[model samples]
Target: MENLNRSMKLSLEFGLSGAVLLPVIYEVYANISTSIGLFLVAAFACFAGVKFSALKFREAFVGITCTIAYSGILGWVCYLFIHPRVVDMLLKRSVYFSLDIRQQLYFLLYCFIILACIYLIWLVRFGLHKAMEKFKSNSEKTGSYIENAFDDGKDDENL
Candidate 1:
């Protein structure tokens, strides 16, 4: 049972890591200029992740640093694939008061990425809270069952 719970938690973390990368991937596909913004956001994510992971600063700092490095590598790969098209588009077009197709696409992508990240963070927190409550209840029930079983065994022995 404990192993099952551990595996579930590991799966949840894997899902979250994939979810977090979706925005970064989408932004790369839609617009390369936004890659810089994505990297900065990712850095912030690392810091936020550490803060929210509920670990001591000393332990979390390393995790946050590692997260930043991982994000940077992902950002680099994304840039490699998407930068040329974005650069070409920018070169061919001039700035205007109205948003162009590329600009609009970038805007929409940015919004979606932000929303997805926020939602994932919220979901993770909610899941953790519920898991803690369930663990507490299960622990109490187990403790009571053990106590009752021991008492019953002692009564039988006396009789």
Candidate 2:
């Protein structure tokens, strides 16, 4: 029952996002390339996230598959509505193409660095959880031993 509710909520959220993106995606994709390469890269990012979230193989694959389908469908819709004229104008006016390639590459490198920082945060969270688990296990063992020792001492006193 809890699983059903969670699934329903996720469905609603995704549906709402899709509906909202349908209209705004054109604006987002205007500067971004419409190439298959970009789409695949986005899909891969989603897949990596899904894999990280889902520990089991089946669950991970299911998430990746769903994400790929959603990404493609959403991207297609965004592409269809994108304002190409505005994008073309921006591209013509921008110094990106005229600027040093090294600078552009450095900018992309910084973007990846930011993403790596976010990944590090997740790693820290995972480490904290493992530490907590280890602490809890050790405490439980200590508790059991103390209880047994007390029981033995009580028996000796009573004797």
Cα-based TM-score, every candidate: 0.38, 0.42
| Ten contiguous residues minimizing lDDT sum, candidate 2 | 22-31
lDDT of 2 by residue, 85-132 (tens): 445666788722222567445433433443233234434545666789
* Candidate 1 lDDT, 94-134, residue by residue in tens: 43133469875765456446433533554465468779989
lDDT of each: 0.51, 0.45
**C-alpha lDDT of candidate 2 relative to the true structure:** 0.45
lDDT of 1 at 84: 54
Candidate closest to the true structure, highest lDDT: 1
Off by over 4 Å in 1: 1-33, 42-101, 152-158
Who wins the TM-score comparison?
2
